[model samples]
Target: MRKERKMDVDDEQVQVMDLEAQQKKTSESDLPKIQKKAKHPVILKFKDVVYKVKFPSQRKKFFKQTTSSPVRERVILNSISGVVYPGEMLAMLGPSGSGKTTLLTALGGRLGGNLKGSITYDGKPFSNQMKRNTGFVTQDDVLHAHLTVTETLVYTALLRLPNTFTKEQKIGVAEEVIIQMGLTRCKNSIIGGPLLRGVSGGERKRVSIAQEMLIDPSLLFLDEPTSGLDSTTAQRIVSVLWELAQGGRTVVMTIHQPSSRLFYMFHKVLLLSEGNSLYFGSGSHVMDYFESVGYVPSVPMNPADFLLDLANGVSPDESEDIVTVKEKLIVAYKNNIANELKADLREEENEEADHRKEANTEIEKWPTTWWQQYTVLLKRGLRERKHESFNILKIAQVLIVAFIVGLLWWQSKITHLQDQVGLLYFSTGFWGFFPLFDAIFAFPPERMVLAKERSSGMYRLSSYFFARMVSDLPVELILPTVYVIITYFMGGLKRNAASFLYYLFSLLLSIMVSQGLGLALGALVMDLKAATTLGSVLMLTFLLAGGFYVQNIPAFIKWIKYLSILNYNFKLLLGSQFKPGDTYPCDGDTKVCLVEDFPSVRSVGIRGQFVSAIVLVIMFVGYRLIAYFALTRIGVTRKSRTTKSWLLCLD
Candidate 1:
């Protein structure tokens, strides 16, 4: 028994010693024996990308807006070689001056550049359809500020989803993203306004996330996720991204000044300082590399921040060795045997993406016929186009101008022909034509919104063109109604009110025709200054050639009078109210007073409302069509229809 006890004691001591040895080994290994290097996980191949973006450079002169400037030397991204794997999250990190945003923008196909490299999805080259599966959320939240959280998500779902995703599917998709992103609390709140009125910044960020996720993108790229948010909020945003990465979707984010919370959210970190890479792989391995050098990372600190401080240099002036050290670190991370393997793997993935894309039959992803889709898009555009201030200002000007002019005419004595002719100048040629301002000021604002929405696939120029015509009818009619009624009542020197009413209608038609022409002028000249100048020129031309001031012009210029919408309408108006032999020439004794009607050429032509209305209304229609065709062909973009097409399928 004593011998057995001694043996048991010896065995127990052996076990304890073994345990201690293992612990010692772990402690030493965790600290790194020599310099430590990180390893790259296998990269997953994405499908192809087709990114063609045009980035407008600041021109030396404004003339570049009208006359084309040299197409910028486009950056080519024909094929991006890096293949981020399914289980991994790759961060594009760079120095402040480095082209991180530029790269992101190029990758997303938002910026037009020289794209030489072919970016493959799996193994196949990129196609339009392949790109549809990828979601890119820009740094700024591109959302309608007026919409509530639910409204936004629902809208996105409606627009982006396929027809196959039924109402339940949409609701389910939105709800899932909301839960995953921690947006449950403020899902009902408005997007933005006074801080008190809407969702918090964090919530808005999630809403953006939910919007992108509406299509269930396989690869999601977020450009500078932490740009405008507070540290805590930024961290929260990162956490949601981590949650997404865990769900098997690859996430690539360009992050700046990440809080420790954000750092912890990342499973891997690719540290880029300047255009060169500093480190890649597990974030936990970062401290060991620095420790090998003389720099010791402090505790309770953000390692990313600590690393950047060292990488940028302690002061403006960096020692030669530190600069060399940063370069060497980057070279080791990106150029070593491990990196070679990662590169090879990425290439293979690219080839596979290409093969898959090329092999698959292309499906028509667009929702409906081109015309039908545009019709829907136009309706939406038209609704947005009807800004309230435009009509309000126009109607007020018309009523006030007509009333004052008529009152002045009523007060004046109609004693002689010259006096009546002078009054004709006061009524037609002299009255304020402020309604033309609508075309001048309005087109630019609508143009900006249209450009933006069109870029995103919001609507078509044709639909917007038609809607503008339809909506503007009320807008156009309002002024004419005011002008006609006010002038008819206020001007008491009426020969025959039925004839006077014809004059009012004719005047209304003339103004509307001018307004349409002005709108066309606005669309033609993109710049506000140029458009304004053109508008002034139009007004001058009409007033001069409109027969009030100038009785006769050259035969060639006389044709210009026919072209002058003002001339046709105004001519019919004056002719309509003429009463034959209602003459004034030399007064008394069978000698009529010198007068406009007493002239031999004073015989009336057409006086009916139908004549002027037909001419002016036809002119308006023709002008609108000209604007539509020009815009549809040149002014509007093809991308607008794409987004709308994507939206309709969701519905």
Candidate 2:
């Protein structure tokens, strides 16, 4: 019996060894194939990068003092310098106000201002081609929440990948990225928002990274990739980055409070303090460098924590002044790492001059055509807006308002001039107000996603704007049609088919114009709360000038009525109901008064409200143009001899 048991144990041990061998073989086969370096391996180097902005003086309030001069110049980055080579995972660490993110944006060439610095890629000045080849992952995920993980990645791949790739190839890349990021299990799951239940935070973060990876960029920049993630999930993300670096792509990211294990995964570390670099060196050697300089950690602490403490001018014993310690570290870095960085850059330049010429000889255009962009974006927009566009609440709001108004003015007669005027005014005001508010939320919520995608050169501002406008029109017209259908017959106005059709057409045009105004307001304000407030105020002002409550205005302010959408819509609705030469019951001083005999446009000019309809169309196009410009001009800076607000106020 003992001999038989020994034989079984030996057999089990042999089986375990065989399994281990097979696992090793599988991992080896799965490894990314090593490829030769291209003529242009990107090596990013920035020197003396200084970024500054001017802000208004608090004493000179717009309502009070009225002086237009700015009193303060805030320096966001103070002569920062760094070198990032290919095949390196560089980690940037800093405290709350350390300018880490600012520097990253500057390096990615996304910031707008008077930048005084030298930033070179591949031993030459950075060009749009380099920008095209670079991938940037912003802190916010900036994804469409309703889209499934696979659908989101596939759409991004379509927009970003080169046109040379076939549709199947683009889809394959999306699938590969999903497998690589370990997201295949939930690829069909939706990326839910704050109010929705969907994927986990970690999965969403992975999807963000996956989208950027589809293009296979040479250099990637990420801002806070592991932010709002658990320690284990954060470590997993860093591990993937390490693998990417090993595959010969340059990865630079800003991290806050990374775990010790995650810290060790980085090949290099750049530490910043108040816009100053206190240390830029190898990650493994950072602790030793600090120790040699007489600043050793007394207890077992995270290397990330220790480095942040040193960067913030805190010593191990807490006895030294911050300024003194900061100065000491700055001087030490200058003496130790600065020269080494300079020497390495010089050597790379000497070796890669020929490669630079070959790599950047031609500028690359967008992979997809304008038409392709428009179609793809239009489809995606329609899909993304499916829930918001025709939701029950919005439809119900319009229906309930229309039903209430219809009941109140049940079968209103033209004999009662005041009641007819009130119905016309209320219809105009309600449709105008509802659609305008609906459009207000459209652009502000998607601004960040648009900004990020625009920075990546996915599509033109015109294509995106046009596609969004077109996709929304169909679904948006549904509720307005319902409102008009229910209200027009119930209120007993315009019983003839021709008049009813005219009224319905006028109402539809008004809703579209109101939505355009809302879109423009949203783009101009760029914040939901601010846009909503401004929209409400504008609606109230337009209501007052709508030619119903207060007629016979002074000539000076009569021109303001032209600016009111309510005025034109109300006129059209009134003109449709009271036709040319139509007579009303004789209750007034004048018996059998004709509709055209009223003292208004009926006898004066532009008969039948056709001109009003044309004007409404013009307003729709005009507001849409304003919205396009507002969206395109984002992140613009105007340097007049005047002060600018620190808040993101439109110029």
Candidate 3:
């Protein structure tokens, strides 16, 4: 009786599992079908594509044992060749160091440095036109966490699509992509990740894909779209890619490990091991080819697992070692498929030169005008900052600090001249420190996002930097204004209205200069901890060089004061505060008297105010220019291809 009860319970569990599976199928079926479009065939062919790069000392340890040298040259990808036709989804399968992402970047036209290859689209050599018509979805999704799905895609479409598209047309395209990506249910939801509350991981991934789809490129490349997702979610993403391919767009993506069901969705598979192709053939024929080569799989084996295991040095032949099996497979692939690819490419090469020329000419033009990019980026910047940029905490911090400072220097009188000087110094330091730190934290997190957008040719670096700074000016003005209003009267400065306004303007200039320094520092270093440390050290040096700290210095080292932003600010403030033709009460022994009928204007006269303001303006523009150069150089890093994506993943 007990045995029968156990059997009945097992049967009940099986039935429940079947019911859940049925429900999942029903839910998926209820979603809208993907819209179809006319297919444009883009035949991508590469021959003897070799990528050789210098391995910095830090990265040399990851490769085979190398000699001790200052610089090392390593072949990342060796004599690789393959072809991916239109309407096909090619899956690049490999272990971590297999250079799958590198290959993808090379094909997508983002790779730099020493690359030797012949890559052609259609029958002509690859050109800028090919790049313009291609879209790349990185492994790490880089979206504004504060923006909703619809907002993010709208902005992307506006920047990426042609200028001929009307604003309403851009919006329509965004909505269509949203529905195509199956993100309609969460269209209005924010794309929050670790730092905020919003959409799920699956939704975020879809948003990234949706963003690239806005351009309607003939070719799309994705780097590990299924990584970090569950089996069910991974399968769903693959199914979406399959639907995309059905519409005539060529899709290529690097996949780490896909389930057996997901594996069959690919039209072709390119298996890479240590940067060399082990096999390049139809997805269905991969197993048959391996079996023909004597790597027979057990019944009902997961094909993806079997291939990954083989690439990772798992040998099926008991008599042969793992390395031997890999070599055998590589040799067999080259002998069978490599020559055929080259021969076929030769046949197609003479077909069309005029068409390629026309495409190249059309691709030379920017999709949108410069003014359009600036306005769109400006809007995006403002919207992204709405929630977190001016939070209660920042306002409270400024007010509390201002109140404390006001109390410390309560209604300071001219009789206490040293106290007044101290107040001036303190105010300069406060404005310089807070604005600098605020700007420092602001740019590093956005560095990755900027890199991703820049790589996609979304806008000019100058436009993005200008738009960001312009958007930030309003908030930058607020804190310094609040500090001045609260403390100016309490500190008891010159009572004239013109004098007060001059002082406020000087403080604003100083704050903006400080903010520029922060942006430069953050852009100089991609790592937060490193940037913070460097910024602190530089700030301390500037503080020492500021005039209030050390009045007289050796002539040789006196030049340091010029680099100190605070020194210039203080001079402007002091110059504007005192009248030129007034006598000051002085002690008999003192060279310069603090308590007097009228203060001396010898150190930096009224002229200093105008000169310093001009200098501050120059500094603001200078730092921003440096930041732009830094960002452009940082799109690719030593660590990985998805540097910006990794940055977005950080809180």
Candidate 4:
């Protein structure tokens, strides 16, 4: 056993060495050359960009205070200005709440507020074409945990790459990006989550970068790419970004305090404090700039650490007031570095006038067709969610419920009219709640991924909505079908082929309608706990009004039954089991009686079975439509109008 363990350890070590060598080679040679030939260089320039948000403020009165609060504006980015040219990586550094991320978002054309600014790409205003060619890497990696690195990238390529490229070509691009990002070693590993063990954190971050790199974007913006990483891993990530910039793509990233080695990788640095720019110039010149302004560091320290200290109002000279030092730095930057940056930006604008016009005139179009998007999304949804849908826990729950219902009403006789009716109602109520509670959790977790992809203009909201609906139908229905099959015969309901077929159809329709309600609730709320709570209330109401528990509902509130999915479903199930004039043996030596006269049977009459099915069908479609529209209202496509307004502002 000891020898075997040693052999396994040796194998792992060898793999690690091989991976390191491959990564080194790729970073040195492959990455820089990968996109150089196809690169479209962009110069990102922003001048006098100011962003402010409104918040409610309550004013206390000495005599009588009102409950209402007036609105007040707070500045987030105050006249911040900088420029980043192709082949340069600009790092924005500051402490928390310094508006580093806010500025980055503004430059990426994603910020919305009372934003006053001029942000241009290649001397042109923001446009749909510019959006297509830009990449924004968010701080939280929004990725599906079940997909492997290759699968994730390939699907992204298919969805986002232009349709002119053959499917095979798009796939090749994904593979090339995988190699360029040095992800070939873990190409087949899952992008795991908190509960699952998959790739290392460094590898996962690389995969996120690789997804954006597949398009060979001319401009890239990352919000704290090196956050939560060790010094070595952070250095490696910045190294990759440096190589990407070297390939002629302008890169801008917000980074927190970095080591000296990592700090020097930035070509230019922007130091911000309280929404004010303290310095904007070459990274190497930051120390000199600070010294010239009479704030030199007394001891050797990492530039990032020193800069952060100054931004936090920690003066190099402890005797000097920190607030005075910060004010002096801000004033000095406005007088010196800010003017130089504006001059450089003007010169570059004049130099690129013709190129800017041509770039702005380019037409905008989706990369893939609606049908293609639907198909790809459907396949991906199935692959990612199949395990959850068919896992042992879910299947066992359904089976257990089925067996319990069957045993409790085992071989119930038609003479026992009450027992038979009770079994039908229990089945109806079980399915009604089972599918609903399961479905309410669908969209909350996926909201992040949806927003990320939709912002990138990957696919249409309609395509994604329909794909989700279709993909869930087949897998979601299987257990319900199994449950019905188990309980139908064991409970001794009608034994004929026609009776069984009608019974199965009714149950299946109920499951689907219930599942649709779940999706609608999930999408509408987009909060797991809130949606679950709402679903519980709704399912309980439907169950109570389903014609079994309550026979004499008030006329004013009886209309709720029309809206209850369970009401229609119970009617269909009753019709399937008991028909008109069906006689059942009665107690006290009675010969026969009409089943319809019973309170349970009379409440849910056998009439209008066809109408009930039609109502269910409508509910299924109507609920999904509500979900899709709710998603639109929240964020999916609503941002397009915001993007247009942002573009107009740049113009």
TM-score of 3: 0.88
TM-score of each: 0.67, 0.87, 0.88, 0.90
The CA lDDT of each predicted structure is 0.56, 0.78, 0.77, 0.83
Superposition error at 120 for model 2 (Å): 2.2
lDDT of 2 by residue, 267-356 (tens): 889998877777787886777678777887776578899998988889999999999999998888788877776566554554467756
Clashing residue pair totals per candidate (backbone < 3 A):
50, 0, 0, 0
Better of 2 and 3 by lDDT: 2
Q: How accurate is candidate 4 locally (lDDT)?
A: 0.83
The alpha-carbon root-mean-square deviation between model 2 and the true structure, to one decimal in Å, is 7.8
Better of 1 and 4 by TM-score: 4
Per-residue lDDT of 1-651 in model 3, one digit per residue for the tens?
A: 445535544654564466446434633673344556634568888778887666445544565886766656666677778888778999999888887887888788777666787777775665656656788998988889999999999999999888779999999999998887889899999999786999988788889988888888788999999989998787777777776777788889999989766776788999888778888888867766787677865433667888987888786555677798789888887888878876765654335556566545646445788899999999999999976578899889889988998898998865556677677778888888888887888778987698788778788877788898888887799877988888888878787889889889988989989998888888888678998888888888888777666666578988887888887887777765665543333464355543323232233334556778888889878887787777767564223333332222121
Please, what are the lDDT tens digits per residue for candidate 4 over residues 228-324? 8897787778878877887888999998888776666788999999889999988867877887787766665667888999998898767677798
- TM-score result, candidate 2: 0.87
Q: Candidate 1 on 1-651: residue-level lDDT in tens?
A: 445535544654464466346433532442112111111122244222232334345457654545565543222222233456655667655456444554454455444423344444455544445455666776766665556677667655654556677767877877776665556677777776453367776677777777777666666778787787887567556655655665667677877667654554555665555434455555555655555444553333566677666556442234445666666555555554235535564445565656875748665544234555444444444444455535567557666778777876654443444444445445554332444656555465466445533444433455556655566556666656666666555654455767776666666566666667667777777577887777777777876777666665677777666666555655565565444345453654466543334432232222343565677788868876666654653323224333322221110
